[model samples]
Target chain A: MRNRKMAALTTVPYVIWMALFVVIPLVLIVVYAFTSKAGGFTLQNFSAMGDYAKVFARSLWLALAATVICLIIGYPVAYALSKMGPSFQRTAIMLLMLPMWINFLLRTYAWMSLLENTGLINTFFDNIGLFDLINKIALSLASDPSAYQPIDHFQMINTQGAVILGMVYNYLPFMIMPIYSVIVKIDRSMIEAAQDLGADSVTVFRKVIFPLSLPGVLSGITMVFVPSVSTFILSKLLGGGMNMLLGDLIELQFMGGAYNPYVGSAISLVMMIIVMICMTVMNRFGDGEDQAVML
Target chain B: MSEKLINLENIHKDYGGKVVLDNINLYVRDKEFVTLLGPSGCGKTTTLRIIGGFETPSAGVVYFDGKKINDLPPHKRPVNTVFQRYALFTHMNVYDNIAFGLRIAKVSENVIKDRVTNMLKLINLPDYAKREVSSLSGGEQQRIAIARALVNHPRVLLLDEPLGALDLKLRKEMQRELKSIQQQVGITFVYVTHDQEEALTMSDTIVVMNKGKIQQIGTPVDIYNEPKNAFVADFIGESNILDGVMHKDRLVSFCGKNFDCLDSGFEKDETVDVVVRPEDFEIVPIEDAQLVGTVKSTIFMGVHNEIMVETEDFTWKVHSIYNAEVGDKIGLFLTPDDIHIMHKS
Candidate 1:
């Protein structure tokens, strides 16, 4: 009885913290999502999302691309990390996470400098003679005589590719950490058992390791997808306001020149519903139900 | 046996610097249930792994079916292993787990199903095909593990302490069932364990090991009765080892009493270690006995009374039907066959 009382007492601070930070803010968002400025219930805010459908479509597509790219780059890195010695694994993980210690906005701003029209990448390409090849290709593809002007540098900045690069760079560590943890926790005996039963290295991986790591892969997908789908800073700075995402549209309603909190709340609510649906679909596709509940 | 099915030639294994197996040579005949019995970290599992091709020996070669196969990976070898913890794939159900090897072999779907059904029946889990591996009991999991390995019909099956996780009753039941399964399948089995009783109960031949070396390799009776060293005598069963002197052939003296033993050829007054099993000692009267001692402790085992008898120089364990109280005098007699003599180390 005394232990129960002590436990209940210890939970008081956490309960208060959750109510103040999580519950109240969520209630306020819901109230604003469904109510007008005169404190009257209305569905106009929800109908407002139809106007920004292109932004939502573009954001989802870009986020999907970023997620796929992260999985492609992160799976091998996580597998290699799991195979390293303990001290080496620790150092590798620390290095992977070192960039996140700085301000996220500052890091996103740093990409703007590197991906600009006259940026470091174009300068490096110019040194490697890739700029000359690109110029010759453009000249050959031109139709008119005057249109055969040589290209000076590639227009890589403010493109969808630039926004995706930012998202992959910022969210890749999220992908690697979970997959690495799951791979490391896989029992060594399972691999040996597979081999002992006449499974070669490739068969063992296809039959044992890959299937076992799906839970981590699912979690990594969600981790990278959710944030990339809802990000505003990367699309604004790296995309240079040319490619407005759902987050950018929502930010415009509440904090930008639009200044409408009701529409912002409605978009936030819709994004939450979309993310929840995506997660459910992913969990159904993979055998991540056991781990999905945990997350 | 016509020829050794598996022969390990001068197998030496070293981990970083410390040697786990040193100059080990062993041979397993076809259809033999051989056990590698030793304490933990005594290289028994290492020997099993080397045969399974999980670990490469630092030196020497392994032969399977009279051909050198030292460099063959485990997947290419004609052997399967039932790991210590069962190592069942958690994501797979029992049916898929059993069918994994058949699928890898590219067996037809119909044949895979038939073999899996037979294996499930063989392990006595007909209705557990669709159940997840994690839901099964320890004994059920162990049976599935055995079934998974046996389904491949490998030439040899290696089991590394497969029953170490079970309760006593389940372990005994599994032991009998595993022995019968091995006999039924006619596959050579190389089992590693530290349990002496388990080794004696199931193995056709027992290889007693200690500190990276084989102490003795013999049948259960020979290992128990005619141990080659004190280590084997102490490890195999309860023994009352004592210091004695060999006067000449058929004559030995210990506890200030001369005893008649089986034929022995040694220098005069050569020191030897004598092993006498506790159950071998007869509770004779003091007048007709060769040696006598005072009882120190008595324990009531289920079938016999375990009494410790202390002489002036050594303490002896005597297991007899007759109970002797503490501090009581008891006389013990030994026959010539009961005395096993070895050079003192």
Candidate 2:
């Protein structure tokens, strides 16, 4: 009885903290989502959400593309890192986490300068006569060479691809860390057992290694997808305020030209619900197995 | 006699200047249950792995069915292994774990179901087809590991201390079960274990090893009754080894007394080691005692009393059904056949 009381006492601070920061904010958001600017109950905020449908679609699509690309690039790197010697693995993991120590905004700003029209990449391309080579090929293929305008610098920044590249560059280490930790902890005898039972390398991987690493893959997808979907700064800085996402639209309602907290609260609630639904569906794939559900 | 199925010729294994196995030559016959018995770090498991194609000998060739299989990978070898910890795939059900090899070989689903069902029945877990691997107990997982390897019908089955993780009662039960399973399948089995009792209970041929060298290889009775040296005698069971001198054809001198023994092929006054099992001593009256001493300690060991007799030169361990109080005078007698003489190693 004394131990139980002590445990309950220890949890009081955390409970108070949650109530102050989390519960009250969630309650206030729900209240604002259902009320108008004049403090009267109304559903006008939700009815007005139809105007930002394209923003929602663009946010979800870019996040999904970035997540898929991260998985494609991260899985093999994690697998290779897991196979290295212990000292090498320690060094490699340190290198992977080194970039995360820098400020997130600073990293994204670095990408901004690198991807500008007169950036280092475009300068290098110009120095190598890459633009001339491309124009020559276009001239050779065109039926009307005079109508074709000569190409100058590649339009890399201020595009959806640049925003995705920023997200992927920032979040890839998150994907690889969990997968590498999981793969490194797998028992060595399991692979030996598979081979002893007449499984070749590919068959052993398909049957044993990949299935056991599903929980890690699921967690990696979550870590990369959640922040990418709700990010406004990357799209603003890299996409140059043109391809606005759901986060930017929500920010505009509260702090931009439109200053209505009711519509902002409604969009925030909808995005949270959609993300929760996506997570629920993803966790269904890991139903009977052991999974690390971060939420 | 059955034909020789596996031959390890002049095998030597070293790991970065440290020798793990030294000049080992062994062979296993078809349908014979062979055990490599030793303590930890004695290279018994390394020998078994070499035969299973998990390790390649540093200097020798491995022959499987009269063909050199030194370079063959484990997947191409017609052998399967039950690992020490059972290593079951936790993501798979019992049915899927057992059917893994068959599926890898691309056997049809109908045939795989039949074989898997038969293997489950053989391992006495017939209704556990849908049970997860994590839900099974240690013994149940051990049986499933065996069933998984056996479902492929490999020519040889290698077991590396498969029962080392179980309790005493469960290990005993699994020992008999593994023996019967090996007999029923009629496949060559190469088992590695450090437990002398388990090796004696299951193996048809026991290869006693120590310090990366084979001490002796024989039947269980021969290994127990006629150990090659003092190390073998002490390792297999409780025995009192003493330094002695072989004075003549049938006489040995130890504890400042000469005794008649059954062994005779030693030179005159040649120094030797003598072994006498603790249970071979009989409690006799002090008047008719060949050797007499005062009892130092007595322990009740369920089936017998273990008494320590402190003589003038040596403290002897003797097992007898009769009990004696500590510090009491006692006598011990031994027959001529009970005194085993061995060369000093």
Candidate 3:
């Protein structure tokens, strides 16, 4: 009885913290989502969500693209890192995590200057006559020669690709760390067994290494997709406010020209539901063993 | 006798200048159950891995069916391995795990299904095709691991301490089962183990190794009865090795007494090592004994009592069914055949 009492007492602080900061805020959001400005229950907030459907579509597709790119780039890196010697692995992993030590906004802001029209990348391209060569090809391809205009610089910033680049840059470590740790923990004997049973390198990867790394991939997707979908600052800075995402729209309802907490809460609630559904679907694909490593 | 299916010539392995195998030369005949027996870090596993193509020897050549296969990868080699830890794919079911190699080889699904079903039956887990790999017991998993490798139809099957993880009773049962499986499969088995009893029980030929060098290779009975040196004599079983000198042909002198032995070919009055197994000493009356001592300690070891007797120059270990109390005088008698002589190393 005393042990049970002590355990309960130890949990009291966490319980109080959860109730105060998490549970109460969620309850307030749900309440606000279903109420009007005058405090009467109404569905008007949800009914107005159709106007932001394009924003929702843009956010989902962009986040999905960013996540796929991260997987394509991160899986090979993690696999390679897992095969390195212990000291080299430590140094490589530290380098992968070094960028994350800086503030997230600071990192995204660094990408903005590098991707501008007169940024370092475009300046180097111009110095090499890359824009002039592209213009020459464009002039030859066009039917009317006068319609082709020579460009001085490439417009890399203020686009959806730039926002994705920012998101991928900021969230890449999240994807690689989990996958690297998981691959490193895999038993060396398992790969040897696969090879001894007449599996080549590709087949061993397809049948053993890749399937065993699914939990890490799922967690990486969750880690990268969640923030990329709801991130507002990336769209605002790199996209120059043109690619307004769901997060930006939600931000606008309460803090922008439209000061309506009701609609903001409703959008937040809907995004939460969608993210929860995506997570539930993903967990079905992962075997329950390595799922705890996500947190 | 069958043809040699695998051969290792002048095999040497080292890890960054630290030698693991030293000038090793061994061969295995077709359908022979050969075992590499040694303690841990004795290069037995390294030799096995070299045969399986997992590790290339630092300086040597490996031949499979009279062909030099030193550069061949493991997948291309006609060999399979049952790892120490089973190494089952957790994401796969039993059926898929067994059919992994077949699918990799692009075998048809119908044939894969048939082979997997047959393998499951052979391993005595006929209804376990759909069960998850994580849900099986250790011995069941070990059997599945064997079945998984055997389904590939390799000419040589390598086992690296496959029964090292089981309990005592289960290990004994698996040993018999493994021997039966080797006979049933009729393929060359290169098994590695450290347990002397396991080596004796399952292997047709046992290769004893120590310190990256081959100590002795022979049949189990020969290894036990005629160990080449004091190391093999002590490693195979309990031994009372005494430093002595050979008096003449078939005669040895130890404990200030001359005893008749079956070994010869030693120079007159040359120093030698004499090995006598604990079980070979017969307890008799003090007057009828060749040597006598007081019992220092006694241990009941399941079927027999092991007693330590302290004599004038050496303490002898004797295994007998009769009980001997500590501090009591006892007598030990040895026949000519029980005395083994070896040149001093």
Candidate 4:
């Protein structure tokens, strides 16, 4: 009885913390999603959810695109690193992962120097003479000069395209690491087995490696997509107000221009639900047994 | 006799300035079972990998059925490997595992089905076609690996310790199974293993390797009875080596006995080592004894007793079915056939 009481006492803080920080917020979000500011309880939040059609579509597109790019660029680098001798692999991965140790926002700020108006790219463009100031100014002029007039000041600084670039840069290593560990763990003999069976490298990769790397790929995708869907800082800093992704809209209602607590809670609730749904879909394709077998 | 199927000429492998395989020349005759026997780090697996096209020779050529396959990738090679882990395609069922190669070669669905079914029967796992590979036991998985590799119909099958993962009983069972399978498939089988018994029991030709070099290559009988050097003799079976000096053309003195052996061509009074098998000596009466020693201990080993005889010159063990009490004075009889002279390293 004493041991049980001690165990309960030790767990008391965590239980209370979970109830206070997790359960209450979740319950509040669900409650806010159903109720509205004007009345008691209704599907007003669901009705207002339609108001985010453009944001939803654009956010989904950019998130998916970033995730895809992450996988494409990260998988090979990870595989290459894994193939190196153990000592070399250890140092190389350490170097590759060093950038991740710093603050994520600082890295984003560094990319700002690269993508900023009259930044490195613009300076190159100035020398080349094909483009103008900020990444946004060049973008607005190229896409639609009439609706999107190029601002004299830091234009294109905050835009959907810039957000995607940030997302890709940020999530690429995450995509690579999981995929790399899996790829490295995959028995080299399986690839040989495939080939001895008369499979060219392409066929072996397709039939053996790609299918085996599915768990890592799916999880990598989930890692990138889920985070990108919720990420607002990049969109806020890089997307020049012409585009408003779901993250930006959530930021607006929660902490910025619009102080709509009900809408903010509703968006958070929806984002969590969507993330759960995506994870479930990924896990369904990534059968637990096959995933265990892959590594 | 089947023609030579695969030939490796002066193959050498160096990794980062460290030589893993040094000037390895070998040949695999058609439908023959060749085993590369070596201790760990002796480059046996590396040699097998070179044949499988998983690794390239630093300075040599591999000819598969008279075609130079030095630059060919593993998939393009006319060889499949039953990896030590039996690297079965876990994502695929046993049927798909067998059919993977056929599908890769663009065989029709109907043909693939037939071939896979036939292979499943060959490995004696027809009903297991639908079972996921991870669900299978170690022995079953090993058969699946063989089935998967064999279904491709390659000219050579490389088995790198395929039964190494199995228990001792299964290892013995699989050795027989592997030999029969090789005979049935009629493709050259290149197996790699550290176990002398497995190689001695299964292979037609055993290539003994040590320190990344081929020490000796011969038939199992040749390897065991007449090992070329100390390493080979010691590695193949239990051997008692005694330092002795040649007294005459056919006689050598060791363990306080002047034994007549067929071995000759040693300089008069030259120092040499004599290899004696424990089972070769027999217990005899004291009057007819060729060598005398006091029994130190008697170890009962089910069918036979291992008696350790301590003598003035050397300690020797003799296995006999006759009961001998511990610490008894025994006269050991060594026939001319038991004592073979070996080169001291």
Q: In order, what lDDT does every prediction score?
A: 0.91, 0.93, 0.92, 0.84
- Kindly list the per-residue Cα lDDT of model 2 for residues B174-229, writing each as its tens digit: 99999999999999899999999998999999999999899999999999999999
- Give model 4's DockQ, 2 decimals: 0.71
lDDT of 1 at A182: 88
Top-DockQ candidate index: 1
- Ten contiguous residues with the weakest lDDT in model 4 chain B: B1-10
How should the candidates be ordered by DockQ, best one leading? 1, 3, 2, 4
Badly placed stretches (over 4 Å) of model 1 are A127-129, A136-145, A285-295
Q: Which stretches of candidate 3 lie over 4 Å from their true place?
A: A136-147, A292-295
Please provide, for model 4 over A49-133, each residue's C-alpha lDDT reduced to its tens digit, 9 standing for 90 to 100. Answer: 7888888888889999999889889888876787789999888888878989999989888888877886777666667654444
- Model 3, residue pairs in steric clash: none
Name the regions of candidate 2 deviating beyond 4 angstroms. none
Error of 3 at B4 (Å): 1.3
Write the number of the candidate with greater lDDT, choosing between 1 and 4. Answer: 1
| Model 3 lDDT, residue B139, Cα | 96
What is the lDDT for B227 in model 3? 97
RMSD of 2: 1.5
Which lDDT tens digits does candidate 4 get at residues B1-345?
Answer: 137688889988999999999988888898888999999999999999888878888999888788888988777777788888888898898888888888887899999989888888888888988998888999999999898888889878889888888999988877888888888878888999999999999999999999888899999999999988878987998887889878877899886668899888888888888888888888899889888888889999998898888888788888889898878898888888888887677
